[model samples]
Target: MTTVGNRSITLEDFYQILFKDNAIEISPAAQKRVSDCFAFLLDFAKEKLIYGINTGFGPMAQYRIDEHEQAQLQYNLIRSHCAGQGKPIDTVYVKALMVARLNTFLRGKSGVHPDVVALLTAFINRDIFPVIFEHGSVGASGDLVQLAHLALGLIGEGKMWHEGRQVPASEVLAAHNLTPLSVHLREGLALMNGTSVMTGIGVVNLIHSRNLLNWSLVSSSLLSEIVESYDDHYSAELNEAKHHPGQQQVAAQMRAILQDSDLVRKRHEHLYDKKVTADVLEDKVQEFYSIRCVPQILGPVYDTIASATTVVMHEINSVSDNPIIDKDKGSVYHGGNFHGDYVSLEMDKLKIAITKLSMLAERQLNFLLNNKLNNKLPPFVNLGRLGFNLGMQGAQFVATSTVAENQTFSFPMYVHSIPNNNDNQDIVSMGTNSAQITSKVIENTYQVLAVQLLTTIQAVDYLGFEDRLSSVSREVYQQLRALVPVFTEDGIMTEKILKIKEFIQAEHVQLPASVVGQPAAVAATELVAS
Candidate 1:
């Protein structure tokens, strides 16, 4: 089924809307819930004692104020928090934040009126996103500052980007037959304090990063086999002895992919056989830890994506609003469930996994480039020109730089909490920085793997006409070859590498990662049994 925007927002739907160019919908039930919250707040405003109504917020939640000065309170809350510094986040991420914020309000517990929810929902379905900055949220009080800007925009009070045009939210809404929304009771706080900002970013980034891990494996293993490393390194017996389930899966997959290769033959003792060279048994003796230790590493990547996904999925589906309704008890429970610690922990782990994958990709490229280690290939696969080939020096440089950046991104942002709001938020999650960093890590990872692909195709050319690769590897080479021709003269490797990256992204890279990470990989037993 095509993913539409609603509470049922899965990672696939997220991919569809965020990356795959799919549209979304605002369900009727969700609209009703949103409308109900807004209506309740409007009637409840008669009691100005409501915290965040005609009263000061946060550390001053107990302070009472005159109803006449109430409108300025909401505006003041947004303007003061607009202190977010640093470059703006990607526009797509900003849209995700809007969608998530709108969805949470749909759960009907926030007491926001239906009209306000309908407006936010319309913004999502119609692709209208508020301008949100990157560095404002401390992530403890739930992406406070950035989301305040979003809330302000929802009420037609802040600025937004609409249909490729930037305009004041009040003007845009007015132009579209709308008006600034009424914020009564806890409506402003309901819109502002939640994990929507970070959770939306976390899911989109983690899923994409997870997909890149798959691509990194595909690129790395292609280079590993091209270098003619022993298939024995992927033996099930070795992995089974270690008994790591992930490693077992990786070894098995490698064995399966390399199954029917003519290249995997036993050495013949005949003198005539000596004339034809196969992969050297000694130099190919032990595959490097980068290739052999893949499952052990990428297993963690898989785990990170899964773990983060679970937390974010729940965050999106449920009512993250404070003072959650309890019709059964006829009361509300105000709590800190809105705190984003869960998302922070998962994002930090994701950052590490992404960094590891980028480094592995760069390491794979280095192996392919080092002629001394790559069996008999020229340094940097000089591509038969020796003196004339520009080769993959530039691709290698980019891969190195990208991986370095990923390492820098992996530093845990969650640990650095700053006090805010009169010591009320003495501790924080920094989930905002964590999620944003996770996004950057994924981008760096893409560039790193792109370079590895360029170098791997070069290594494949250098290993030509040898004892052939397995049918599967041969087929994969065929796909890659469609984009990257043999690097015989090295005209422009950059475009080729980029095109291959696009190809890899177009298809979900899951199966290929499994193929390379075959922890249960065993030797070719078919011909021996035959």
Candidate 2:
């Protein structure tokens, strides 16, 4: 079991709970602080006017609530904003959101009743995910609509996902013998007003995007080997001259992957040692930019992921609630900590980086399919009679179209704010929208790479290059080829393409320890197992 609220939750804790099914328990210290904060707020609000407690919210804040109707006000806030539209977010992401919210509450700055923490912990450990939507939340004022749905579920008033089916939150709660949250002081506002929803989705995007980069690096390494390209492009002597750490690291990782390969040529041994007789050499001096400049191209992507991780991880551990309650100081301070500019900008940048990565994969795939560019294999790497087979020609359309879609979807959401709530929220951050779009871009890139990997293996088979590949490349080739056989004739490849995409996304590629902060591998292994 992973203990929450004892220390800050790391990305590793998230991975274990969300992916590995680890249960969570709230620490006693956090629980006592939550209770103390609630006690303080209950007394503090008895004679004083507090925002969202005694007054109306947003533009309606001037209107005050009567003492008899204060509890109803909280419930009304929750149910009214439960008006989110569009497809429900996936269960895994909703779980992440719940975890983020719970951690914020655990900080004891939200004045939430300890029951809120208990319910959220129960929901996460039992896998009872609230049905959160993708379309709501301008990401200012703290993912209002999306988190309203979360608040609704906790109050046993909305739908939830349980055991792979949509069910009433009340029924699920009863079955588990759990009590619904009763609003005390500002429980509803505390739950609904924060950046946890956007931050949660951004966290999920970070993990998948990092995994995609690892696979892309794997694909690029194998592509270099397939063309018998020169090793100097990824050499330390060449990359070290540039001061960017990401570039040098990428080059070093490539060398580690290609270190034992028999296919990659040494520039000094090939061209420098021998005298050239022909005016125009048969061997092209250097490969295409996509093949040779991988370190430079992907280096920025590495830096972007690193930068986003630092910001998101900090956001995860922060208390993003409005009107931070301080029992220790005997005071409450109100501010816009809920604003999501940090996450919104990072998500926008992350998607743009991923889109570029996909474009690189498409270009590499193009190089392999074009016989004129490569001068090595048949067009489209078709192994059958050239004209009749058509080979991977049809699948290239999917990759091209998908990359185009990603390019269009890469528009930044951070600057696209429109005033709403009668212009009360004149400036807002559409951070949730940014995170959702970034997830789509990441998913699309995986599909593009799926096509690229399938095509690459086809080219490898055509030249019988498996035996001469580096051990890492050989292992990846064998696993992928096992999923889809070499095609000699034109056939429906939709299912095969889907299979490869699923494989790439489901199985974490074991990159060098320096590359991904994990142990380097000589054999294929799942990241969790390693």
Candidate 3:
């Protein structure tokens, strides 16, 4: 179980709530703080013209609202802003948005009534998710359109995802014996004025990116074994001399994965006096850059993922709304804390890193498929009659095409701002678009990595030395083989490829605890601080 708003929330905590069926509770202290803040706001708004309270919002802020219509003002804000137009976002992301927004309110700085927080908590705990759309946010002024849809759901005015189906919010709330939220004072503005959309998507993206990174390392190790590559490239002395912690960690992980493999050649075995076979003598002294530079290439990726995780985690735990009420000082400060620049920049960096990782995996897949580069493996790793089978020839093209798609999405969304909101939000973050692209990139990467895994297994089988595989590699190979059969006959492969992608995405395979540790968990902490 997890307690929302009582303390800082981590990515892991959010994942637990979403995937682990963990229940959530709002603490008494948080409720009291929220009540106190709302009381202060009510008293403060009676005399002074407060933004989103007695006064209008955005470009119309100069106009004052009649006191009798304050509640209607809040209601109109939610109704007018329900402008999202794309397909409904996945329920999990909407839930994440709710949790993130709830956390912000729990900070007791948004002047939201405690009932608002309670409704959000109930939504999460009951698995009732709002029907938020994908294309409504510019990531400035707090994802207003998308969040307005969320606010609409809270008021039993929009659609919701209930029991795996879309239903009217009024019907769902009625069935659950819950009452629609009554917006009071600044509650509507507080609900819509934040970065929950980007933060929620970023949290999910960060987790998927981490899983991809781990699987990339595993795939690299398996490729090295398949090619009978030399172990000198991952030597501890070489990585230690570079003094890069990420590089060293990659080297360590590679060493751990390739530890007991007989296929990886030791340096001493290449000595002139060893009396090796002629084929052994002809082996390249070094490998292609994709195989030789795993540490250097993927080291920065690891660090970037760690850094992005830190930024996203901090965003999840922060109070990112405007007009922060400092009850202690008895003052309200309106600022642009809702700007999603932090998450936008980090997501851009993460997408580029993931793209590079996919590029490397594609190259490795080529090395395993092409006869000229794959040593003794047959062309396309085909095992059928020489002229009859195409094998994985077409699959490699798909992997390359996916990699190209990833490159296209890798462009930074944060740098392309356009004016909206009557130019009040002249410079926007486009964080929701950035994070959505990052999510697609991650999906594409999973497919690319799936291709590599499938090719590696085929190559290993062609070599007929499965007995020599490292223990972990053999275990993973067996697990995959259980799902996908060897493609000796050359038929349609779309289903097979998708199954592997799903398997990876579902995290059915995991590295042993020894290969990943506390170092990986905290790698970005220091980087984030700097």
Candidate 4:
């Protein structure tokens, strides 16, 4: 079981909990911290006026609540903001949201009752996810609307997903012999006012984006090999001259992926060692930019994803809540620590990087499909009668259309913030919206990559060079060939595209640590089965 609260959660820790199904346990030290913070808030609020405890929230902070109605105020904040409108967020993202929320409370600063973290832990371990919506967070005063839905679940007032079915929160909590959280000393305010919703979704997006980059690298390597391209483009000598770590690392990975391949030709042997006999050489001197400039095209994408991972991980460990209760200092500090601008900007940048990666994948797919460009494979890589049968032609439309959608979705959501909440949040983050859109772009790229991979295997079959490929390329080709055999005549490829997409997403490709310039876990990871 993964332990929360005792220490900050790492990306690896998140991967274990979300993908490996490791249950969570609250550290005893964390439990004590929560109890202490709550005890301090109780004593401190007796004769003093705290923001949410004694006064109103947002613009209504001017109104003071009666002593008897303090508890009701917390409940009112949660239920009133359960105004999220849209389809429910996927359960995977909701699970991430729960973990992010639980971690914040575990920091012992939210002044929340111990029962809040305990209940969240129980829900996470039992696979019980609150029905959070896709919309309803401007992300300045935190993911208020989205997290209010989370708070509603904790209080056992709304719907939740359990055992693959949406059910009432009360029923699920009861079935597991678990009780819902009871408000104590600002529990509702603490739960509803945080950036966990955006942070959680951003974390998931980072993981998938990293996976997509690795697959794109793999696809590029295979494409280069299939066409007997020169090895110098990915060589250390060529990439090192550029002086970017991502570029150098990508070149190293390409070299590793195409190791021991008979298909890639040595530059000197083809040109320097031989005398020119024919005035016009039949073999093109250089390949298209899509095939030759893989490292240059994808280098920035690698750096962007790495940078995003840092920002999102920091956000995960941060306490993005209002009125931090410092038990040691015996003070409750109020400020806007809940702002999601950090995550919002990172998600926007990440989607832009991914959009470029999809464009690269599309260009490579086009090179393979158009025989005139490749001069190696038949039109559409069709092995059957050229005009009568369509091989991967229909699939190209899917890739092209998906890439176009990704381009449209790449528009930055960070800059699209609208003023809400009585102008109190004049400059909002729109962080949740950014993360959700990034997730879509990542998913769309996977569809594009799937079509490209299918087309690639078909092209390799046409060349009959299955045995001459690098070990890694050979393994991938064999696996994809097994999924859908090389089709000669026209056939329905919709299911084949999906099968390959899911297969590659679930499959983990671990490049050498020395080559990737990072640990195996960071360089590439398996997508958790969704």
Q: What are the lDDT scores of the predictions, listed in order? A: 0.69, 0.87, 0.85, 0.87
Regions more than 4 Å wrong, model 1: 1-8, 35-48, 162-165, 170-180, 235-237, 240-245, 248-283, 465-479, 490-497, 502-530
C-alpha TM-scores of all predictions: 0.84, 0.96, 0.95, 0.96
Q: Candidate 4, which segments miss by more than 4 Å at Cα? A: 507-530
Q: lDDT tens string, model 3, 1-530?
A: 79767788887677677766799988889999899999988787678877888889998999999989999999999999998997888877888888899988888899998889888888889988888899988898989999999999899998988777888999999988889999777889999999999999888787777788888888899888888888989989889989777788789888988899988988786754487657645778788999999999998888888788878878878888888987878989888999999999999999999999999999999988889886689988888877799888889999999999999999999999999878899999999889989999998999999988988888878888689988878877888898897768978889889888888887334556556642222222233323
Tens-digit lDDT string for candidate 1 (390-448): 67876788888888888888899878888888998888888878988888888777777
Candidate 2, lDDT over the whole model = 0.87
RMSD of each: 6.1, 2.9, 2.5, 2.7
Between candidates 1 and 2, which one is better according to TM-score? 2
TM-score, candidate number 3:
0.95
How do the residues 1-530 of candidate 4 rate in per-residue lDDT, one tens digit apiece? 89887787888778778877899999999999999999989998898878999999999999999998888999999999999888999987999989999999888898888888888888888888889889899999999999999999989989988777789999988988888887777988899889999999998887788778887988899999889999999999999999877787778788888988999999899898988788998898888999999999888888888778888888989899898899899898999999999999999999999999999999999999998999889999998997899889999999999999999999999999899789889899999999999999989999999999999998888999899998878877888888888888787889999989887776244544434544333454221111
Against the true structure, candidate 1 has what lDDT?
0.69
